[model samples]
Structure formats: C-alpha cells, structure tokens
Target: MTNDENQELKRDKEILSHIQHRYDEEERRFQSVDTKISSMIGVLAVIFTIQASLFINILSNSKPDICLIVLFIFSLALYLISIYYFIKSHYFKKFSATPKPSFLMEEGAKKESEHTIVKDMIALYSDCINDNEKLIENKTNIAKKGFSFLIYGGCLSFIFLLCFLLELFV
Candidate 1:
C-alpha cells in the first residue's frame, strides 16, 4: 500500500479508538448514577424503619397527640413517594451498546474496505452514546426529585420527634 494510504488507515483506527472510549465512558457514567441511586435507597430504608417505629410508639399511647399523628402521616407519605421515584430510577433500563458480534462478523465477511467498516462502527458508537446519555439524564432528573422529597420528609420527621420529646419531658 502507498504511504498515504497507510496514514489514512491509521487515522481511521485512531478515530474508532476514540469513539469506543467515549462509549465506555458513558457506560461508566450510567453505572455511577446507579450506584448513587442505590445509596439513596439504602438511606431511605433506614429512615423508613426509624419513622415507622416511632410512629407506632406514638399510636400505641393512650393519649396520642392529633398533631403528631398528622405529622407522621405526612412524613410517611412523602417517604413512600420518594421511594417510588428512587426505585423507578433504579430500574434496569436497556442501554444501547455496540453492534452484535454476529453482525460485525457478517460485515467482515462482506469484503468491505476497512475504512468503510470503521466509519460504520463509529456511527453506531455515536448513536449508542447519545441514547445512553439521554437515559442517564432522565435517571438523574428523577433522582433529584426523589432527593427533594426525602429532604422534605426528613424535616417533617424532625418536627414530629421534637414534639414527641416535648410531650415526654413536660
């Protein structure tokens, strides 16, 4: 092959390598978002347990305060909503990956030029990257809403706990 042809082939390979790397990076980012969602779920579980136990204690008392009951109900409702969103975000949605091996093999057997194959693969990689990024963005937005609910629920719980303590000591 001519020197110019060799250089062009090398450049195509380099471009393919960069596209593959970008695809991998997007996958890693998706996993990172999953990890964060899992962590949030864990914390919510702990908070739910504490809230349930405290609420039960309050309800069992003969003279349970009406305000405490209302606060607990609101807090628990918010937590449930938050959990729903968190679980929704955590659901295993399908991600776009590279073309299957069989397809690649078929392409190889077609006797297509290497440059053509590389360009096609680059296009596939770009599509996958775009799809995965959109999924990640959606998950991120859902998680943010869940986080907001969690914070609001926590505030309600704190108020309930403070009132409970006041009633106990006074």
Candidate 2:
C-alpha cells in the first residue's frame, strides 16, 4: 500500500478500536448505575426497619395520632414503589467477548474472507453501542425518579417524627 493508503488503514483501525472501548465503557457505566439503585434500595430497607421500631414505640403511649399512622403508611408505600423502579431498570444485557468459531465454511477452493467478516462485526458492534447508550439513558432517568422518591419519603418520615414528639409533650 502507498503511504496515504497505509495512513488511512491505520486511522480506520484506530476508530474501530475506539468504538469497541466505548462500548465496554458504556456497559460498565450501566452496571454502576444499576448497582447504585440497588444500594439505595438497601438503605431504604434499613431506614424502614428503624421507622417501624419508632412507630411501635409511639403506639405504646396513650394513643398514636391517626395522622402519624397515615403518613407512615404513605411513606412505606412510596419506598416500595421506588424499589420497584430500581429493580425494573436492571433489564439490560451485559456485553462479553464473542466466542471463537469452532469451524468455518469453505468455498469451492477457499474459506470465508476475513475482511468481510470483520466489517460485518464492526457494524454490529457499532449498533450495539448505540443501543447500550439508549439503555443507559433510560436507566439514568429511572434512577433519578428513585432519588426523588427517597427524598420525599425522608421528608414524610421527618414530619412523622416531629408530630410524634409534639404529641408526647401535649
């Protein structure tokens, strides 16, 4: 190949390699976001356990306010739905190395050409990368909703605690 042709081939190889790397990175990022969602759900579970204990303590007194019970129930339901969102977002396939072919077909006097196979593979890989980017975008939106639920649930819990304390003194 001439000097210009060689340079062009090298550039194409670099671009293809970059795309493969990006595909791996986006998949890894998806896993990271999914993991964060799961961890947040775990934290909510622990907080709910603590809140249950507080709720029990409040009932041991003369009488718990009906509003306090209602708010706690609402908070629990919100956390439950948020956990569902986080779990629902974990619906993507992980990318892995393609397996080596066990055998190959032969033409009248030759096997399949490597160039065509590689070109097709590169096209498929590019398409997968695009699809993965879209999946991650969706998961990110779901995670944001999960975060909003956690915040609102926390606020309701705080309000419950405040009301419980106020009733104790009154």
Candidate 3:
C-alpha cells in the first residue's frame, strides 16, 4: 500500500473510534436519565402510600377534620413538587439528543464492515432517541394530570377545613 493509502486508513480508524466513543457517551447519558426517572417514580409512589396512610389515620380519629385538612395541604405540596421533578426529568431525557453517524458505503467501497457498523450504530441511536422522546411525552402528560389532581385535592381539603372551622367556632 502507498503512504497516502496508509494515511487514509489511519484517518478512517480515528473517525471510527470517535464515533464509538460518542455512542458510548450517549448510552451512558440515556441510562443515567432512565435511572433518575425510575428513582423519581419510586419516591412518588412512597409519598402516595404515606399520604394514604395519613388519610386513613385522620379519618379514624375522633377529632379528624383538622388533622385531615393539614395533612391534605402538605400532601398537595409534596405532589406538586414531585410533579415538577417528574417534568424536569422528562425534559432532560427528551432534550439529550445525540448526533447520528453518516458514513455511507457505495459499490467497491473499502472498509465495508466498518462502515456498516457505523451505520448500524447510527440507527440504534436514532431508535433510542425516538423511544426516549415518546416516553418523555407520555410522562409529561402524566405529570400534568397529577398536577391537576393535586390542585383539586388541595381545594377540596381547604373547603373541608373551612366547614370544620365554621362548625367549631360559629
């Protein structure tokens, strides 16, 4: 092989290495975001379970009204914050887009296997990004629903408190 040919081969190797590095980086980012979202879900589930317990306790007590009202307000705040984190995490997952490789192989092209691998890597990255985008969109909708529920619950709790206060004082 000529010097020029050797230089081209080295350059191609470097390019391939760079692409692989980028792919690895993107995969790590994707996993990190997935982990965060999973953690958030677990936390929200725990919060919900605790709130349910609080509600049950308040209902079973003799002087339940005030306690229920206070607990509901606190739960509403927590729900709101959880929803915010949910949305933020969804956005992070959505916006972490990675560039796709664009090395096409023609007839009689050298390094066909390497080129094909790069193309496959690009396709994999594209698919992952698409899936993440869909997941984030769904999560965003769910978060909105959760926010609405929190608002309604808070209002109802406040109204209950008002009634209880009226009955007690007036």
Candidate 4:
C-alpha cells in the first residue's frame, strides 16, 4: 500500500481508539456511582439499626412523654422513606452494549475498507455515549432523591434525640 494510504488508515484507527477510550471511561464512572450508592445503602441500614435501638430504649422508660412518642413515629416514617429511596437508587439499569447488528450493514456490500471500519466504530461509539448519558442522568437523579430522604431522616432523628436528652437532663 502507498505511504499516503497507510497514513490515512492510521489516523482513522486513532479516532476509533479515542472513542473506545471515552466509552471505557463512561463505563468506569457508572461502576463507581453504583459502588458509592451501595455504600450509602449500607450506611442507611446502620442508621436504621440505631433508630430501632433508640425506639426500644425509649419505650422501656416508665414515664414516656406522648410528644416524644409522636417524634419517634415521625422519625420512623422518615427512615422508611429514606430506605425506599436508597433501594430505588440502586435499581437503575446499567448500560450494556450489544454486538453491532448485521442489519446495520450497508445495502450495497463492498470490500471492507479502513474508512468503513472507522465509520462503523464512530457510529457504535455514538450509540454507547447516548446510552451512557441516559444512565448517568438516571443514576444521578435517583441518587439525589436518596440523599434528600437521608438528610430529612437525619434531621428528624437529631431533633428527637435532642429533645429526649433535654427531657432527661432538665
């Protein structure tokens, strides 16, 4: 092959390589997000354990205040909402690319050239990016919801604990 033709092929290959690299990066990002969400779920479980223990301890008290009981119920509801969101956050689907369909082949079949390969690669990379974009948005939205719930739960629990402590000390 002529030097010019070889150079052209190399450049096309470089473009495809860059796209593949981006595709891989997006995949890694999705995995990282999934791992972080899983960790958050674990933390929420621990919070639930503490909440349960607190409820039992409070109930065992001989003179239980009705207001404190109401606070406990409110906090319990918040915890339930938080756990639901955390579980939902982990449920977003991961993007998995399938092999290029044979139907995508051009109607007029010709010898496979470097240009054709590069074109196909670019198309596949475009599809990959599109899929990843949706996945990222979905995961992010669900994560936000989960975090909001968690924060609300924490705030309610803190208020309850502060009031309960005041009751004991004063």
Candidate 5:
C-alpha cells in the first residue's frame, strides 16, 4: 500500500523478469544444441545403414571386384568425415562455454568501497553471461557445420552404394 513498498515490489518484479529471460535464453540455446546433435546422429545412422546394405549386397551379388572397390571408397570417405566431426564436436564441447571466475573479492574496506566492489561484481557477472551466450552461439555454429557435412557425406555414400548395387544387379 505504501509508495516505498510499491517501488520495492516493482524492482523485485523487474529482477524476476530478467532472471526468467536469462533462463529461457539458456534453455533455448541448450535445446538448439541438442537438436543439432540429434540431427548429426540421424545422419550417421543413415550412413551406417547404407554401408551395411552395401556390404550385404556386395557379398550376395558375388561380384567382389567392382563392389569391393566402391565399398572401399565409400567407407573411406565416411571414415574421414566421421573423424572430422568427432574432432570438431570434441573441441567445441570441451573448450567452449567455460564459466569464468567472478570478479567479487573479499578485501574491500569501507562501505563506499564495498558498494563499488559490488557494482564491479555485477558487471563481471554480466560479462560472464555474455561470454556464455557467445560460446553457445559458437557451439551452435559448429554443430550446424558438422551436421551439414554429415548429411552431405551420408547422402553421397548412400547414393554411391545404390549405384554400385544397381550396376552389380543390372
């Protein structure tokens, strides 16, 4: 009912809104990362299916020469692409999104000095949050790149296998 009480309530509401926004942003980033990873896994699964079918077809057709060569090339390409993706995912997840140390220290003297220190601490925390956002963006970019290449590589291998099968049977 009081004016001061209303002002305090308004400030608290604003702070709560800001915190919710940050949490929502973080959750969205995490979901984006998860989606990218799931897509990459799907791509890999398709590649493996193709490879398996190629192997079975090659063995069943009894034409080892041509089928073997095609399979070898396709497998080699997939292997190389997998290695690249592995390295990229490894590095991105390992180095990115590392939280930095807070700037608040325990050595401030006097009330005014403590106030300034608290302000600095808040600024540092904000900077860290910004840094985390940038890191998430970087991770998303890396995942997107990896997923794109994975899809391309998987499709290429699948097509290659299909062509080989067609050539063998027809």
Candidate 6:
C-alpha cells in the first residue's frame, strides 16, 4: 500500500476506536439508569410498607376521622401512580449491541478494502448509539416523574402522621 493509503487506514482505525469507545460508554450509562431504577423501586417498597401500616392503624381506630380518611386516600392514589411510573421506567427495553466476533470475521472476509469495513462498523456503532440515547432519555424522564409523585405522596403521609399524633396526644 502507498503511504497515503497507510495514513488513511490509520485514521480510519482511530475513528473506529473512538466510536466503539463511545458505544461502550453508552452501554455503561444504560446500566447506570437501570441501577437507579432498582434503587427507586426498593425505596418505594419500604415506603409502601410504612403506608400500609399507617392505613391499618387509621382503620383500627374506634372513631376514624373523615378528613384523615380523605387524606389517606389521596396519598394512596399518588403512591399508586408513582409505582406505576416506576414500573414503566423499569420495563425491559431491547438495546442494540456490537457485532459479534463471528460477524466481524465474516465482514472482514467479504470486504475487499479494510477502509470499507471500518466505515461500515462505524456506521453500525453510530446507529446503536443513537438508539440507546433515545431509550435512556425516555427511561430517565419516566423515572423523574415517578420520583416527583413519590415526593408528593411522602409529604402527604407525613401530614397524616402528624395529625394522627396530635389527635392521639391531645
């Protein structure tokens, strides 16, 4: 190969390396989102447990206050919405992966020019990166909504606890 061809080949290799690195980074990012979602679900489970106990306490009272009952209902609704969103965010999403070694070998054998092979691989990686970006953004938005609802539900539950305490002590 001529010097110019050698330089071109080197440049293509570098570009391919960069794009592959980006694809790997995106995969890690996707996994990070999944981890966050799992943590949120765990927290939700704990909160749900606490809320269930409080609800039972309210019901067991001889004279349950209508106002408290209404607050509990609203709070319960918010918690349900939050859990729904969380589950949606945690739903399985198929992500594009890099080509397997066998596929790479096949492509290498079929392509006459290494440059063309590199270019094709780069294109594949780019497409996978784009697809993963969209999915990650969607999951993040849904998780944010779930977190907001969780906060709202938690605040209401706290208020209910305060009222119950006041009623009991005074």
Quote the positional error of residue 76 for candidate 3 in Å.
4.7
What C-alpha lDDT values do all the predictions have? 0.88, 0.72, 0.59, 0.78, 0.58, 0.85
For candidate 4, report its TM-score.
0.83
Per-model TM-score versus the true fold = 0.90, 0.80, 0.47, 0.83, 0.58, 0.89
Model 2 lDDT-worst window of ten: 99-108
* Strongest candidate by lDDT: 1
Instruction: Arrange candidates by TM-score, descending.
Output: 1, 6, 4, 2, 5, 3
Clashing pairs in 2: none
The local distance difference test score of model 4 is 0.78
Provide the lowest-lDDT 10-residue window in model 6: 56-65
Alpha-carbon deviation at 60 in model 5, angstroms:
8.9
Model 1 CA deviation exceeding 4 Å by range: 1-4
lDDT of 2 by residue, 5-32 (tens): 6676666677778877887787688778
Better of 2 and 4 by lDDT: 4
lDDT of 1 by residue, 48-120 (tens): 9987996897779747689988988999999988998999999948677788798699888999988788878
TM-score of candidate 5 against the unseen true structure: 0.58
How well does model 1 score by local distance difference test?
0.88
Task: List, residue by residue over 1-170, the lDDT tens digit for candidate 4.
Answer: 79988888788888888888888888888888888888988888888888889677876874668887887778777777877776786787767663346624651265577677677777778787888878877887888888887788788878878888888898
Clashes of 3: 0
Residues 1-170 of candidate 6: C-alpha lDDT, one tens digit per residue: 89998898899899999999999998999999988898888888878878888687776874668777877878888888898898899895866788768869889789668888888888888888999999989999999999999999989988887887777787
- Give candidates' CA RMSD values in order: 1.8, 3.6, 7.7, 3.1, 5.5, 1.9
lDDT of 3 by residue, 110-140 (tens): 5555444555555655665566556656665
Model 5, 28-144: lDDT tens per residue? 776667666666656566656766676666666675566456655666466456646644653564322212332222323334443344444445445655766776777667665
